[model samples]
Target: MGAWGPGIFSDDLAADIRGDYRELLEDQVPDDEATGRILAAYRHLDSDEVHVLWLALAAVQASLGRLDDEIKARALSVIDRGEGLEPWQEAGPQGLARREAALSKLRTQLTGPQPARRQVRRPWRHVTDLQPGDLLARVASNGDTCLLRVARIDDQRVGAAPVIELLDWKGQALPKDRQLRRLRPRYRDDGPHRPMTYRVARLRKKDPDWHDAGFERVAQGLQQQGDDALPPWSYCGWSQLGDEVDRLVGPPKAAQ
Candidate 1:
């Protein structure tokens, strides 16, 4: 049976899935051996397809007290970037989310109270119920002083909006938080080469009350210039905020 159903895959292909199954069962296979199994499984599957297998490997590694940076990294990537929802879509709806949860927990386990790059024990804030096209937050980026907007993928079951995407100032996609199960043992940085931040004062200059709005046309123009000409000002996924972000969680209901 295929991931979603029997129609998407053939019977023999299903049978071969078992061969990969045993490979997944072994807990303490040497690095070379574990890697080979992962590779073999990889040839026949995608990151999302082998999510469990990768998660298992990371767990086992932790059990054995082994710290294989590369293995951990790959596992984290799978967790962060999950399987797409529709057969036609590239990523599943909850893929990135799973990785995010996993990453948060993993860091605590690995570094105790102090994780690299990020501080430990930051208060967690999130949207309880998310819908597609619900604007998250504008993040800071690598460019001189520009920022980019970030949005989540649409949920198939929920009939959400599609993800309007763009490359950062570097022509690379924005950084993404991974969604692995055991982030501590197998966490990976799926975040892009750069993380985008809010433009703060400059943004205040435009109109303190209005942030995401009025920036669409400017973002579009910068995006059209491509990464090369981004000048640290390239925008990604910045669509109309006229009624979208406001209706969801904009200035009106925002807490002071």
Candidate 2:
């Protein structure tokens, strides 16, 4: 696991463990079941990674006031035994000292009174009915409309969300199928070095902007042979839709 610091959550695996545990809790899984699922999920890890996982999960459970006795014992044992310190030892005495301090702090927290059990609210998961090749019209508040096409559906931890391609067409009315066929998809500068063709904007039911944004499905199942070859973009928020559309279609026209 990649670790940037000595803190419990500084490691990628530890952070992922925390997120996975909370996700299970948010889904209303029992504490024991969540713990079991997490352990089972990471059971293939080597001895060092297993120690890190146990410590991370136990710390998270303790903070949530749902710490199991067995988990706490396991974490404390790892701390006492100084397991999973090989990387820190390699980093030198300073790094090892910091890691040991972090472990000491965690041990104290685990042994102390935990906060009362907190309720984990289920997040509003975005589920899209749009399939690949479905055409959509995104109507801006100022009456301008931009066309977008669903390139693919990504099944994510929350739910299935559409990955869209912004077509290079903006007007007051939807264009003909033949007209759309000739229009190229817009590209955005991903960074200094890369330009991206697809935008993965997550549209959650709970997002107020999504409800207000005028979206209409105009066509469906229009997949072309090369549509599958488009590179995927990272997921973005629904709120970024207007700015992204503006970048391709220009800002919304002023109202009379």
Candidate 3:
């Protein structure tokens, strides 16, 4: 499945997955014994090998979704480690995000509803459609919202995902691999849930004049007071303002 023994993975671990699986295919080992040997091999894997082994296992599985829960659990265990990792591992938020993305892409490719049972899902437009300087509204996990501008778009392999760069109201760039989810038109409360399950829509195209009425009123006030400057505010206030704008005009049309 990976580099042979004494490298990132142990000899026993590699043998069980790469070798024992083959033995099972050849009828040299019973299914139960092969399963035991494979489970035992997991014990020999170090933190570094966890990811690789999981990926290798996924490669051999006919349906990645079958192992989706396990994959997330084991990947999180290694990527979210509290203790320090070897310097060579380059473990950090960015690295973790990239690895998570790889898993997401793999799962997307490997699993889906059967043709007869499938319903059309909301198609997520390509992030590359956003050009630099184009405005957007981003709603955070807490339901707070903020204005954003496209800062950059990074192209990867021909068929790989493109990284979208966004500049917040303060001009701070967010991590490229930060996960973005689509907001559904309706909602339901099904008990306790992870925050990731809830997503707010990302708005793109909008009428610049949508805020004109409010701005015009403010402008009149400023003229009467002979004050050209508006009240100072931090990003927190901007979030509320962004939310209001979204509510007033509705979500922007996504770029094609």
Candidate 4:
């Protein structure tokens, strides 16, 4: 995996496993079930990755006060065997020293008494019913209503969110069906042949007012050829939808 440092979680795979494990717990999955799911999810890992996975999971479990004997024993075994140090060894003596020290500290922590398990309340995750070709009307704070076309949907472990492209139509009133179908997606100006902008929007669970967010589905089943050629953008909070759309579309043109 990609590693930036010598810590146990310095590697991408380890860090991802830690996050996934904790998310499972937060979703009210029993510790054993969560551990089983994580293990099953990574069963494809080879020898080296297996070591990293077990160690990362064990460390996370310990910190969360849910460390079971099986996982702790497996992690300690990997550490004692120095099974996952191939990359560090290749990094030269200093790197190897740092990695070994980190492993040693992890071993000590694993063997120590862990704190009592903390209660985890299930979190409300953002859920979207939008699909490809669906059109949505987003009302901005300034009373400008923009049309956003759902180019695709990204369904991850967290939830589903739309990958949307802002259409070249914005007005005080939502557009008619004929107008929406004729509208082209706004493209970023700086690129050669200007590429259409795409962005993912997900409702923020922490935002108390997310339910009343100004998004409404207006139409569906509109598609254009070569839409799949557009580049993807990372997900943004629904609260930032208007600003992101404006940034992508640039300043509005002067009144014709």
Question: Top model by TM-score, which number?
Answer: 2
2 or 4: which has the higher TM-score?
Answer: 2
Residue 146 CA displacement from its true place in model 1, Å: 83
Worst lDDT 10-window in candidate 3: 215-224
Off by over 4 Å in 2: 92-94, 129-131, 138-146, 169-174, 187-196, 202-221, 225-231, 249-256
Pairs of residues at least 3 apart in sequence or in different chains that clash in candidate 4: none
What lDDT does each candidate get?
0.35, 0.79, 0.35, 0.78
**RMSD in Å for all candidates:** 22.1, 3.9, 20.1, 4.5
Q: What root-mean-square deviation over C-alphas does model 3 reach?
A: 20.1
Kindly list the per-residue Cα lDDT of model 3 for residues 41-85, writing each as its tens digit: 676767556565554443333231223345435434444452223
Per-prediction TM-score to the true structure, in the order listed: 0.25, 0.76, 0.26, 0.72
Least accurate 10 contiguous residues by lDDT in model 4: 203-212
**Model 4 error, position 57 (Å):** 2.1
Per-residue alpha-carbon lDDT of model 1 for 10-116, expressed as tens digits? 23443344334333433334556755765576576655456444454554444345535665776566545643323423344464344445545653443343223
- Candidate 4 — number of clashing residue pairs? 0
The lDDT, on a scale of 0 to 1, for candidate 2 is 0.79
lDDT of 2 by residue, 66-110 (tens): 989999999999999999999899999999999999999999999
